[model samples]
Target: MRQSFGERFDVPDGYLNTASIGIPSASAGEAVAAAVAGWRSGAGRAGEYDEYVERARAGFAALVGLGADRVATGPAVSALVGLVAAALPAGARVLVAGGEFTSVTWPFAAQADRGVTVTEVDLAQVGPRAAEFDLVAVSVVQSADGRLVDLDGLRAARGSGTRVLLDATQSLGWLDADLSWADAVVAAGYKWLLSPRGVAWMAVGPELAATPVAAGWFAGADRWAQIYGLPMTLAPDARRLDTSPAWYCHVGAAVALPWLAGLDRSAVHTHCVGLADSFRAGLGMEPAGSAIVSVTRDGAGERLAAAGVVSAARAGAARLAFHLYNTEADVARALDALTP
Candidate 1:
């Protein structure tokens, strides 16, 4: 329907692999290129890059419906998850979906020696069984098959006293949902966000009072002024948990994220899901109501590739994702390739 956002990307005709990696918007790509050129000529100022980080941070905060102070910049979801894991008391119990991305589950599992236990159950069971665990960590959308978790169910679980941590890596850019209720929300920028690698974010809710266990100079109250200090004073809010940012990545994100946040996300979501449903219809499958579609056909990945339809193979299925940059043409190309 309203597919005007597709013009922002410069991808090939059949590029449908947003789940694995997104092609950056033309503006974002140009910003990164210009920043690199400035760096090459020694014209870049390290201090100025902090502004880019702040802009990206604020943009992500707006996207998730949280105050910027509640958000922290990071390198990856796993690193932020590690911070949450470290904060858990000994013998804490954590629940996660069976097929959740490892970044959200593995950190809690690694605390096995601390008497902490990580349990995997069906995604549907995550909310129903939330009362059994101290915390529930899961992805908002499953990376393997694009299954959407029940946000209302998670909200009810959190109200019943189970702390929740959500990984929004595969859902944020297109899935419009207010995530203010979760104890922690983390997302990697490279996938759905169309940002460069190394930029990620975490938003901390009032339920989780996590300490900055991996605090560095960037976590200081006045990072630049307090860089060389012994009695470290971290920011009062979520910035205390910040990992040192990857400057160049933030430079691109500074452009991409705010621009994305400003767009009609509901339209973006509809456009993506519409393309996915079109593909499903072409394959004679029911509409899945998700932006990402995964089909378990023999040699589906190879066939799609041979037809110049870019996609990914995950969990023994060919995973095709639709983003704002995709259109009906992409769905047709992918369907033609997979059709018998």
Candidate 2:
């Protein structure tokens, strides 16, 4: 690992598993430590925690090109999906792919209990016929194959009545996504966002953000005031959808999300894609659009790990993901390891 990125991570020998879990930057770790200390000493001022949550929301908003008021914090992508599912029109016809990440599918599947019809479609057919369904939900990138979805095509295919939801866990930090086409978007923070687990965000379009739902104590208009048995009213914005998260996650994300926001995302993405292409070329494979490269070889992951590289095997394909922290040397080591 080279020092090109200015000490972002204590680089492992050859880490290519950002898709599974990202190595938090040094700044993020420090933020977490400080937050833990603050909690331990009980020295946090009033509204200090809210300030941290707001900072995270603001950072996520900038990343996705939405307003901070439109972004809500959640515990996980799965829970955010359930919140989105709950707010959908009754008996909605939801379209999804046959084999999507369960976080993207199970929310709608669970909607079966609410009389919502869940229809699975082939990935190819999804774009052309999206408007036919009341809701279309899919991942921005396929988790197994690292295939990037054509967001522009999907946007073009949608009708006035069609609502598009994106599970962007795989591409949010590293890829440029146009949220203009989505009614809602959810992402887990532990992956590309470069934070720890148990932190997630969901940004809703204006219409969805304004809708009232059955919310928890955190979603109350005045949670502290209502603690004295005062009348409760839901928050007026995306905060109403928030599921209370741990203070540590909020602290870490407040630090990490800004790191993502401060990046030259275009340059980082280009570098990652170029590295993926180099990896594929080394493997005598074709080019890929995203930073993920998949190869069909049994035991490839184990072999790479044994050779001082880390990777993942999913759906019978060994997966390699390159991020800003990765270097040409890392790619070369992985290539040499995989050469067998």
lDDT of 1 by residue, 1-340 (tens): 2225633667888998999999998888899999999999999998999999999999999888899999998899999989889999999999999988999999999999999999999998887898888999999999999998888988998888889999999999998778877888899999989899998999999779676878999998999998895998999889999988899999999998998899898898888899999999998889977899999989999999999999999999999999988878888899889887
If scored against the real structure, what TM-score would every candidate get? 0.97, 0.93
Off by over 4 Å in 2: 1-7, 41-46, 209-214
User: Each candidate's lDDT (Cα)?
Assistant: 0.90, 0.81
lDDT (tens digit, per residue) of candidate 2 on 1-340: 2454554577696899998988888888888888788878987664578777888889998888888878888888888888878776778888887788899888778878768998887777777778788888999888887887767757875645678898888888888657645888889999888887998998888655323344677787876665445566767888888766677888888888877888888887888889989998998988877888887877788888888888888888888888888889889999988886
Which 10-residue window in model 1 sums to the lowest lDDT? 1-10
Q: What is the lDDT of residue 325 in candidate 2?
A: 84
Cα error of candidate 2 at position 23, Å: 0.6
Candidate 1 regions exceeding 4 Å error are: 1-3
